[model samples]
Target: MSAWVFDLGNSRLKCAPLGEDGRPGDVLAFAHDGRALDAGWERALPMRIEAAHVASVAAPALRVALLEALSARCARIGLASTQRAWGGVRIAYAAPERLGVDRFLAMLAAHSRGGAWLVVGVGTALTIDLVDADGRHHGGRIAPSPALMREALHARATQLPPVGGHYREFATDTDDALASGCTGAALALVTCSGEAAAQLCGRPVPVLLHGGGADALRPHLPDAVHAPALVLEGLGCWAQVGRTP
Candidate 1:
């Protein structure tokens, strides 16, 4: 049995099929503006798709449309949520209903990997989630992404130009001041959040970084491991469990 996973985020929709090894096989990403599913998906759906799972933070209407399209292509469809319990870890959100499903899914993947972990997702927004060694979720933090930060700065102030460029490790020089500063701040927040989560767990926790901005932020995150397909990984995990009973 094969599973298709879709992670619909604020800016993009990422879809992938999981192979027997639980890794993404045919991965495709599209903009959030209601584009058709990739042609590959059309060809792949007939190849015995047993289940489909989705996580989205899009508007309700858009989410419905996405789900409907997915339903047309698969036998079973599961909506990912922050409220569900998988294995041992349970979501600890103050308002679990309001928590982004993507964060929850990512944390699920992180917890499955074992040990204490801080999962940081940097996309349109920054999400930091902590899972202890005992598989207990410890809540999380959210903040504006680097792009959102730059946009806010530009929108609020008259002097600062819209900052655009890749993040680098050394930014003391003038040529990369704005880009470096923004990157540095984002990385600082991620590391600090990880450190804080570790402290709360009473031990050091490994950091798993995911999302679009991860590559750009990599230079500044020395202790973080880049796990680009975490959402898909979680989806695979979900699919595997669904088959058992």
Candidate 2:
């Protein structure tokens, strides 16, 4: 039986086929802002599916819309949520629900690879989490992404462009300066976090970068692994364990 996984974030909805080997296949993304599903997007789904697993951090209305859409073509549907412990990973949150499931799934996926890791998600917001080699969650930090910073700055100061600029150590123009400063801040945070995580874990913690904005920061950090489909990969892991809501 064929299955599928969906990750609904604040900015986009991503889906992929779940292969028998328990890995996510090619991903498809649809950008939305609490609107109805696109006609083409609906048409794009497989005609029928054995199971549909979803991890959603979008608004409730949007989540409902997606679930409704899946109900028709999916023989079974599973909604994923944050958990204190699951599939070998133990979360640090006093209230596990406080942590975003996307983040949890990313850490879960990272732990499956068998090593301490500094997982960074750069999307609508920048989120960083650390999971030790033994799957112990070390909590994390959150900050506005470069794009969000740019948008906020543009909203406050119209003279500053909201987008379009290259990152440089010392930018001469205002646009590049804005881009450099915002991107630099995110890079610095990740670098600092990685160092701290290494000290705490007593080993070098490799960085794993994911999310839509990751490519912008990838060139700056050569060592970080780019895994854009990490959340979906983790969702696949979740389904593999037979836990679904």
Model number with the top TM-score: 2
lDDT of 2 at 104: 95
Prediction 2 TM-score vs. true: 0.97
- Residue 43's C-alpha lDDT in candidate 2? 83
Q: What is the clash count of model 2? A: 0
Q: Write the per-residue lDDT of candidate 1 for residues 11-90, one digit (tens) a residue.
A: 67788877887667766777655444334444435555677788888777778878877676678888877665675668
The lDDT for every candidate, in the order shown, is 0.77, 0.93
Clash numbers, per candidate = 0, 0
- Give the least accurate 10-residue stretch of model 2, judged by summed lDDT: 33-42
TM-score of each: 0.86, 0.97
Instruction: Score residue 138 of candidate 1 by CA lDDT.
Output: 85
Model 1 weakest lDDT span, ten residues long: 35-44
